[model samples]
Target: MAVSVTLPALGESVTEGTVTRWLKAEGERVEADEPLLEVSTDKVDTEIPAPAAGVLASIKVAEDETVEVGAELAIIDDGSGAPAAESAPAQAEAPAEAPAAQPEPAAAPAQEAPAQEAPKQEAPAAPAGGAQGSGASTGSTGASGTDVLLPALGESVTEGTVTRWLKEVGEEVAEDEPLLEVSTDKVDTEIPAPTAGTLLEILVGEDETAEVGAKLAVIGQKGAAPAQAEAPAAPAPAQEAPKQEAPKQEAPKQEAPAPAPAPQAPTTPAPQAVTTPAPDPVPAAPAPAPAAAPVTPAPAAGEADAAYVTPLVRKLAQENGVNLATVKGTGVGGRIRKQDVIAAAEAAKQQQAAPAAAAAPAASGTKAPAIEASPLRGQTVKMPRMRKVIGDNMMKALHGQAQLTSVVEVDITKIMRMRNKAKDAFAQREGVKLSPMPFFVKAAVQALKAHPVVNARINEDEGTITYFDTENIGIAVDAEKGLMTPVIKGAGDLNIAGIARKTAELAGKVRTNKISPDDMSGATFTISNTGSRGALFDTVIVPPNQVGILGIGATVKRPVVVDHPELGETIAVRHMTYLALSYDHRLVDGADAARYLTTVKQILEAGEFETEIGL
Candidate 1:
């Protein structure tokens, strides 16, 4: 008996998965519960196990092909199986019986020439039947469907990765509605459907890369069933019926030509040529069907060029203002390596230099300064689009506004002492670890409440200054992909414990790549803790649409003069840190920034969270 192996449901929401790799090929024996193949879904990648101990008879799904849940993936045949065993022998016997049948005609050498020539003339008809059948089936779906192409994501972005698919095969989608999410090096956006129709097929799966304007999927009229599988299966049996009759017809034709073998000697080798190529074309005919999409061929040259430009090289080119298309690549297969981008930037710099400056370097016999390649330079990968977007936003903030940084030394001895005393109790009660960051955020929110100027934004288009009622503070988190700022909405309303929980939740999401766009927007002020990375202080750039960003620095024990109630001004060892505020001077003046920082400094020094933390 042949056991059908169907794709098991991997998740409740996951309707389909792509076959990434097959561990066991057809005809390979497998043990029960053994690993069979690797299936990749948008949520996870896992291996499907063999259902029973048997020979792997056939694989219905090919690698890179996606199939829905409960669809037959492959068949495992035990020794008792008849159909699988019968079909195997039939195909195997056809080629083997050809040689065996030749001996009968060879017994009389006189008739052998004509007999062999008959089969040669008839062999082509079988292949033609098979070829036509496969062609018709493959073209059926394409004829009525509209190809959903990968549209232009952004300027200079030649390709994008399909991060997810919103619609599956057999699902209906509306025009201009988001069907999938594409992530380029510069943007992460949704690609919408061109027309309202049923999604017939998906040429590209999640996490797969496709060039711009390439066919991503196919959409047909609503209520039209997918004939991709049925059409091909229906034609295979019809084509084979004619193929079986070809050999029988050739036998009779050969019987009529019972003549001398001398004249037919030249035609004897003709059968070998016909039989050899007959099998080759049948399999090769269907190979070009997938490539039939007209969008594929025209972008061949562009794919070759853009395919090699990895995200690392793209970012480097953008940072240096070097055009990637113009630079000649020297890496393997003309890949745009990091070194290539660096060299191009140097060349552009030299071109921009004065004539005297260029000549002086040549006269001095000194070579241009070369950047040392890091060990990580050789590795190429598609970086997340968020990184490029972050860089672009930083540049825009610097150029689009009058930005400046102001630094103030803060004595946080009381805050640190208060945290040390209340951390264990706070974690036990709130179920979140007590970190100095939450305290800083609490103080920053409080200061923003007092001095709303730092927490305000200027709308140049409207020519107005808008002061937000609530402090939607954006916490800058260093995620693996890039810098992410997940906002803590209504931070002014949240206490120390609430702030701690929200910060931890947002950071967790950032690290896990689960943070959504909704979590990143609507921020009136942003805070960046450079101190976590051991930095003393940094002039963090203000994000776009925001007027100010507060930079927290590392705290260290230092001797500082302080006034006490009993003792006069005296130098004592205390924990101190620096706070730098980067604000757009257009909306926030020097005095306003100073006042905000001063208020935060006073809050931290006061350590008024004793009751809030149950200290």
Candidate 2:
């Protein structure tokens, strides 16, 4: 019996999803509830677990292909025919085609070998051994090798680029070993080899984009000869006298490509390739060729030295006008990192300064050196999928709602004092650093409970407004990929310490690319801490489905007029920051926005959190 794997309902609004990648390939065994494939929708990217423990028989959908909800994704065959089903499909197809298409070569080799048998007995034996290896493999278990397809990286990621290949062709790899490095929109990770074997071929090269589930490479049976030899053997059957010398001649051609193969090169069919007609001292000479031929072009393109460059590190290098190839990496495995690029850039600037100073008098009257142009000024690379998604969402949100921003200045001198006094104790008790962000979140949630209209959303299709009772506040975290807002559910119910812990946890997840779709959805409101990066308040745009967003600005000590106890008005230095509240005008009027800001301002100014912070 075969079990059908269907795409289950992911969310209420997600009616369809794209099959991003298949974790288990056809004829691969999978346990029940194990991840089978990854499905991506507009809202989230998630994996679909196997419904039953069996051998995957067929895949109805391929990578980057979309299907509606409830569509059958694949079929799993029970133990009744798993072994036969696994090997038989590959053997059946290869044998049926091999015998039919290769009949001419097979016949030609048979006829020519008999006439030259006396002079080339040993030559005939070598070819026979080579032929039998392939023949026996096909007759029994086929050595067609396992296809290494790309796995799903994360939610909403449909495709990935091959950043680097860790193992070259003909290299023996252990099962679950890191075979290559892949970079998707959401994360950069290693794609491990599914089974231990010799790397046979590379289908996708460096910098090439492949959809999830696309075959990236092939892994052949252990100690299998290079597939290149098999190709030349087809044509060698036509030769009359030189039939015995074909394998020896082909051996030299393999050596030309890879001169310095790894020491472990002997493991990859060196015994089989030792069919030298002369007293050939080096049978393993051709071993390196099979592995290095395809990978040789990769280094020539200048990416070999900087194989593990991350997007953040690359962008940093470009912005600083530093050549990545020249920078000595200090990161793990000698990978280039942001600090390495910055250090290289600083060194280059120091070197250029003296030369510029020497020529300063000659160009004394020239205007101060203009800002240097960015290295990416003339380059027009493809926009990342995450950036495109963010742009589209922002544009849709802006067009869908009537939005405006209201700004207010609040004196947070008292709140600052409270945090400074309690931070040490807070960290000791909570096991997490307490930041000013939780205070802002706490105040915003309190205001939302009082002025629900500011937190309410207008449903255009239904022509209704929903004022949520529980405040699920989304904290905007600046991640390497883009701006991600992971929501803290029931924000109104959590105390200041709880809010601090949840915020820290979510922000960590976002930065590390571990945040799931569920952690990002169902926010009744949003808060953007532009102040963290020193912004003086911003008119932050509201995300889709949310009516409002609050922006926090940098706090500074400034002189201000204050009421003195008996002496009347006086000037004092106080901590002051600005807050900008952008809301949908259709649901929240200017008065409502003002009321919400006032409530938040009063909460911060009062500094009434002694009990919550255990101060």
Candidate 3:
């Protein structure tokens, strides 16, 4: 028996989840309670464990596909992977076995199997038997109803918003006919009826969401009174319908192999091929039944590329003002590659430069065309989903807090020299580039310990200020989707190298759009590296609850008045940076802000990382 793996209810509000990645591939042995795949909801990202110990026989859903609660994600073969194959010799022993199993439809409930078996059951008064069989087939076809489900739309798409109903309830529909339109985060597509029948019971309403395999509508006999009738044993029929459709699929799939192995392949792979198509239907829907949308020869890689462009790619395009739509893809089936995005950015720069060069007019200085600004010059475009969420949060944070900033400059020459010396060794050991951010994090952690007021949150309801003991620092990343802050949990406990490694890991996830919601939470303090973009300093907003946010500005080599103990007040070239602290003025006083910033500045300038850096 195969056990089903389904999307469990994560929370009352989390109705759906996206399958981000499968840790265990199909056919891989999975232990009970072991992580099988990573599921991402709007609120959090977590690993879904295997319900039972078994071989993951089949993966019904692919990575990045979304599914709702109770939606079957995969089939685990619990030591029952080869019952049919094992009993094959016995099945082959009895020529009458196929016919014997024909009436198993009585027990099976799929009367459609009788129609498939009828051709082999040609024993009786030919005309009389034919007439009876014909009548039975017609009656079954008419009465046997199908429950139309919200099929797997795309990878990582759990539920679909029903945009419109193409056919209303009580409407007659042909098999594979358009029924309703559904929109997901990545794609918008119209769904089709499973079979030719009367449209009854539109279970999922327009503009509402239904998970994969959730009832969308019901199709019954022609002219049958359309009622809100739930199809009998919907889950059973759902699993079997694909099996019935699998054989009816195109010949191209097996055409080449069938000819060469018509006789030699009676024992092994052929039977598995026939049997495997049952599970295979989930990925590649048969003939007019497309799992995502219209079944095309187009590669799913291309589909994935079109739908889920990584946040980094989107951000790169955004920063460079490159139109992703205009960029041509060089990947499979014209899938947009990261390189393609980069090329487009470069092309955009060249195009803008060409116009400026043309306008320069080769020293003759022909005046550029007086570009008149149109009334609709800046077209009003809807914000991206991530951007909207970010905007809302920023506004909410601003409205809720009385924020103010304090700045201080620090000499990080020692830290820069240390990185320059040990970067290669550190990268080799930690597999992450040694950067100044980790040193800043170390300084912040050390400072937060000394001045816990800046690392604390206010509870107005309780009228209490809670100062956190452990420093969980959130490093604000300008992600492709929006601004994301991936936290370095227990930053105070981790050494400089540990912080560096964790920083790289968290930052990689953000840049790749794989950073889960949990990874973005639990920050007692925050750091914004504005200097990476060459800014001297920025007034970074403190996150809600957290009292302060430290902005680390660019580390630049500049001439500074150095107050040397030995050579008093000498001018020296050093790597200097400005640190800005944005704090909640209501909770943290000006003195508290000054103390934390000054402490962090002192720690960095004091240069106590020799032991950690193996200097």
Ranking by lDDT: 2, 1, 3
Candidate 3's residue-wise lDDT over 1-615, tens digit each?
A: 788999987753457877878877775555565567777665445667788766788999998677888999998887666333333333454434434433332222222223222322321111111121111111112122576766655434455555577876556888888787776544556788878877644544443444444445557875453122222322232223223222221111112222222322211111111223222423332221222122112221232434434344556777767777788865433445567777887787677778777766577756655465777676997665456546766787799999999999999998898889988988888788888888999999999999989889989899998989889998988876667888888999999889988998998877755566667778899999998988999988888768899999998899999899999999999999999999999988999889888898899998889889777
Worst 10 residues of 3 by lDDT: 133-142
- The worst-scoring run of ten residues by lDDT in candidate 1 lies at 266-275
Candidate lDDT scores, in order, read 0.67, 0.68, 0.63
Q: What number of clashing residue pairs does each candidate have, in the order they appear?
A: 1, 2, 10
lDDT of 1 by residue, 1-615 (tens): 889899988753467877878877787656566567877654335567778767788999998788999999999996665334333533453434544543343322222222322433453222222222211111113224787877654323456666678887667899999998876554467899999988766656554456555556768885454343343443333333322122121332133333333222211121101122222312232122232222322322244446435555676889999988888876433455567788999898777666647567455776665455777777887643445456767898899989999999999898889999999989899999998998899999999988888888888999998998999999999876577788999999999989999999999877655555467667889999999988999989998889999999999998999998889899999999999999999888899988888889988988888998888
In terms of lDDT, the poorest run of 10 residues in model 2 is 133-142
Candidate that beats the other on TM-score, 2 or 3, i.e. the better one:
2
Across 1-615, the per-residue lDDT of candidate 2 in tens digits comes to 899999887764567878877877886666566578877665556788777777899999998788999999999987675655444533543434423322333232223212211212222222222232221110111125786877766544555667678987667899999998876545568999999988766656565555555556768885554453453453233222223222222221112222233222222221221223321334333332231122322222345455546555667888888888788876444566556787899898878877876766874676465377887888999775456567877999999999999999999998889999999999999988888889989999999999999888888889998888889998998888788788899999999999999999999887766777778778889999999888888999998888999999998899999998987999999999999999988888899999999999999988899999998
What's the candidate order when arranged by decreasing TM-score?
2, 3, 1
Which model scores highest in lDDT? 2
lDDT of 3 at 602: 90
Candidate 1 Cα lDDT to native? 0.67
Give each model a TM-score.
0.44, 0.57, 0.52
* Cα-based RMSD of candidate 3: 17.7
| Candidate 3 stretches greater than 4 Å from native | 1-287, 291-296, 300-377
